[model samples]
Target: MTFAKLRVRAMMVALLLSIFAVGGRGVSAQTNAYATAFTTSITYQNIGTGTANINLTVYSSSGTPSAIPASTLAQNGAGSYFVGSVSGLGTTFNGSAVISADQPIAATLVQIPAAASQVKNRPLSNGFSSGSDVVLIPTVLKSFANYTSKFVIQNTDSVANDFTVQFINPANGAVVHTANPANVLPNTSVYYDAGTIAALTGTFNGSVKVTAVKTGTTNPGSAVGTALELQTNGVGAYASQAFPASAAATKVFMATSLCNLVIPSGATTTFYAVQNAGTASASVTVTYVGTAGSTPVNVTSTATTIAAGAKASFNPCGLAPNGFSGSATINSTQPILAIGKVSGAGLYTAFEGATAGSAKTALPYVRWLAPAQGGQQTFIAIQNVGTTAATNVTVKYYSGSGTLLGTHTIPSIAAGAKASSNPTSASPSAAGMGVGGGSAVVEGTGAQLIVVTRVTSPVTGGTTGEDYNGIPFN
Candidate 1:
């Protein structure tokens, strides 16, 4: 071997390393999950004809029972109850809750970041589901610049359990960072701050796979019950179901409304992230339902193919180009799971796909009022996803205390059509209605109507708005 040849090879290796900056700086892989403090708000709506007796249970990160609180709510009509209203939860308390109702009820637990004093922020929302050993987080962003996710995982089991999270890059189907945020004791909740974590500091955007293994076993099959939440940049998203499950459906229905032709500056849109969790690649078709007025309008997206191990994001309004505000249904050639983020007018909600003809779509609680200092307003949007037309459908407005204040009933809604109402203008204040407390419930007979809500603050000058989804009583 010649010394001159060896010198040439060493010089080439050094040149490549310098070009890629592969010498000293390295990306960190986040490992070990820890509990970080966050603000949580729990809201529940009574769907029964009568009042509901609700029981609340709280658990800490170590899987210990936190507290037991009980409250009985009776009002003029349908309304909401914050768990802290009857419990000892502080304004900044962080934990998990389980609400049980004597009568039929619907509820959600929301974790809010420190909201701007004069503006609104996106809050992570989740509707409680039963025991599961695994959770699939469809979307996450950390290396995307000013985009990071605060992820929460809680145990629903009564006994201690072990948990692990694998952050994967969707583009290449590679596990980017693996972290064990500590084991979960029974009934406890844990949090992970991706922005501050050293292991997850490297730039990457994709999905999360969370598994809760049994406390004493290393088997992946020994998963206990678990729940999850993820939030970033004033927007939140949640997994509707945890386990590796699939629906054998060809179509999925989503109720939507209002796509501003010129999207506002810093305006995040309503979008769906379709993840093909299956092994074989799949193809999907997306179609929108426009409002039926003096003129009929419709919009659709080109058929898309999602790789077997990857996912895609879609903004329906941007698919073709239309200002139509209404409903949408996605059809696929193979099985798929969809996680939707609906945002416009400063509000966002994590949406779970539903089957067609499945609603008495009602947003159990909404707020609208004009006060001297500030104001609160609400927009209720319902989309009829059924084949049959929805007729004589009504959005019944009520005071937060349960008194029916006013009503706005539309004459008819065609199949795939949507109807929206602003209670502040359309429905005047009625009996016992206060200034800031507002509530609403939807009713109709034939086809199911999908309902989603938008609530804004400072009612008059404030720019903050938050979106809440309606309860579809099965």
Candidate 2:
């Protein structure tokens, strides 16, 4: 039997559980000072044949262990686990988790703040299948636009390792700050708050690169990381995973983007940052592909040269119409990495762009909660990147226990174009998920597909939303 391993960082069962109050406010960890309490949920899907037996082993910040017994899932099926509900995990757990499965699987993590806090941010991130010696974080802010950033790096190697983090100013490609966090234990994680870095003074927005080295040897160690950007005023937050250096490519695809799109709550817009990962300066161009009925537009960066290891920002405000909503393809003269951020209706979210697409994708979490129950809904965007039009595109929804709920077929999607589906809408499968949550799998016959999942709160003008990139089955 073959096994696949995935790692999830900052897997808190109930962060600061001891200090949290039942109905009122309480203080959380330093990483989330404004949050009253933090709970975590992990959703996973089986992408391989036969039944998948998944085992989870969590390691506390101090390297303590807790095990979750194996659970089984059928091929293409999905399931979820609320960390706090697990008997072995216990409350007040702050740690990282490793998932092992007999078959290939994809998982996503959701960190939710308690309702009493009135901070409706649900930060979402995908599990890392493997670690890299070098990782790139496209965006990091320190007191920039009233938002601050924090990141967690996990040591995936068997032994302790030291990681050197460098913050680079995108303007002149200078290293503004460097931090070396020493001796991070195996399977454990370390946290860093950009706001605490004195060197990154007032209003700083930059990119970050982390290099891992073995504690006592000259050899490089393996590591993975995730970052969260939160509003200092406690309004919203979003999370994104770092990209391995090897993941950078000349072409990147963002499945969802908006240009001042007007919705019931407010106007939504998408802004993205592209980082040149090569040694030489490069030029970048962004091409927007609107949904079926809209026009396509290409916008090239005015700053012709983006220095190596530096980043450039772009938005559709001036290039596309106000109501434009669609996908984007980024092309660069050298290898590049990109991440997209969406803000509107008192909500903020982020997702990483894909360097490649797959014929099958997995969305580990989808929900439809009524207004009385937080009114959370999920929207899935599927982009066809193949040369030919995509046909027989289908979405399969499954219950939390791996039961097949329903399947919905989408109309043919044109190459470079995208289609969206709301599981709670007209689809029968969506109806099967009434007032609850589940998982979904998207497959396209003879087509390359890239997916993004966005979860929104029902309350209008409420600061509550999050998004994560779909996991492709390579």
Candidate 3:
């Protein structure tokens, strides 16, 4: 603690402080140095039947004298296209690597139309044929794990073709997978997986949709293409299934958690909730929203719970009170969740027969068209596009003119048949047709329709066909 020693220490501390102030700023600048950027390009071309070629490359910015070399690139085939990434840059990138592809070089596009056509929706048949820019979905229901769906896209083109498969949750219309699109060649079918797809789309959904866009390529063209849709439904924890209990107290079933039965966007999908292997006392709560059916339907007493090691069947449509629809989440503290669906009717009818009442349900694709001006007439058409017959098909209309016209229910419609009617009277009205004029609107001020269709199928668990049309008034 000498005064001389203290003075020396202060001098050293001041000198070190000055050096830190000078060096700290210089270190910060070096660490914060900016890096150059680059870009990428991809293209696809269909040469002929079942064949497509793809080309993907990366290029650095023209502003830089020496761009990132093309050799520092890696490429992989996705659904119908190819994806590329660069490495060894040693820093985060300002310019992202560009990824592009041609539709021809991508995977095939498949369309699953409403299951109205007997031939199209029938069991075990080539659903539809494919042509240039036309994609057909085979009438097959496949499952994948973790709500991840997988399918094979067949390229019936002549040249090497590429494709891009996108996964979408039809239940809520969400995109799940995007596999950088891909390239298919003559006589080759690309088997796409969830990993590649998730990388491309940056997310995943319950069901997947494969879209084969032609990437950039020379002489890209397509002759025939198609994609498959798949879904695992949901995680096991999100679902519950069991036979009915012996006693009334045991009737209540608990699901591990709330389950979500999702459908992809732009997808025509169906879901079935069945009361399997239970007695008449077996019941469940089904909750859901959308055009599938009436929301918050309860499935009760339709299932027969077996005594001890016995089994029985319960149908939601046969429940005590009917005409209800929706999906249920097992949120009750008592914990009673409906069993997993086992090949039954649509959302509403799924619980019918198990209960006792008129089980009226709505159609998923049913919606209203835009409203018409005075003297203008709107035509709402219901087309039976499913495989099975439809019963009690109904279409309710509303006037955007701030009037409720009531509802109209159709008795039935055969497959491939089109039913069209003017929302209002076929004749024009002075200030537009009055309420109950066959014209109506849904939730908002715009014109809308409430559609309902009961499926009639020879098989116990077959689905009905569907189609829709909206005619706007002048």
* Superior by TM-score: candidate 1 or candidate 2: 2
Highest TM-score model number: 2
Q: What is residue 383's positional error in candidate 2, in angstroms? A: 1.1
For model 1, the stretches where C-alpha displacement exceeds 4 angstroms are 1-38, 75-93, 110-119, 122-124, 180-183, 197-201, 217-249, 257-259, 262-268, 291-296, 342-350, 371-373, 424-438, 458-462
What tens digits encode model 3's per-residue C-alpha lDDT throughout 1-474? 221110000000000111122332211111100110111111111211222222232222111111222221112111211111233322221111121222122111112111221122111001111224323221112223323222344443445555654443423333444554355543334444343442434443333323443545644344222222222331111111111111112222211111233322112222332222222333333322222233443333323232211112223343322333232221122212122232212221111111100112111111232233212123343444333445655444323222334455555654323344444332232123332222231121111222222211122243322221121111
The digit string of per-residue lDDT tens for model 2 on 283-383 reads 88888868323555555434457899999888877777788888888888999999999988776889999987789888988887676776788888898
Provide the TM-score for each candidate, comma-separated: 0.75, 0.90, 0.25
The Cα error of candidate 2 at residue 133, in Å, is: 0.5
lDDT of 1 by residue, 1-474 (tens): 221110000000000111112223322321211122223445555556666666666654444443445676554344333333333333334455566666666554433332222213424243443555666666666645335555556666656667778877666556778887555665556665566666656765677777777677864422222222334332333323333433334677777633553334234456786766666767887787564333455667888887664567777666434455556788877666666665544444566565555446546446555565345556777778777898888777766556677878788988777777767434554423455354567778765877767655542232445555676655
Error of 2 at 150 (Å): 0.9
- For candidate 3, the TM-score is 0.25
Off-target runs (Cα >4 Å) in candidate 3 are 1-127, 134-146, 167-177, 180-183, 195-203, 206-220, 223-474
* Better candidate by TM-score, 2 or 3: 2
Q: After best superposition, candidate 3 residue 75: deviation in angstroms?
A: 50
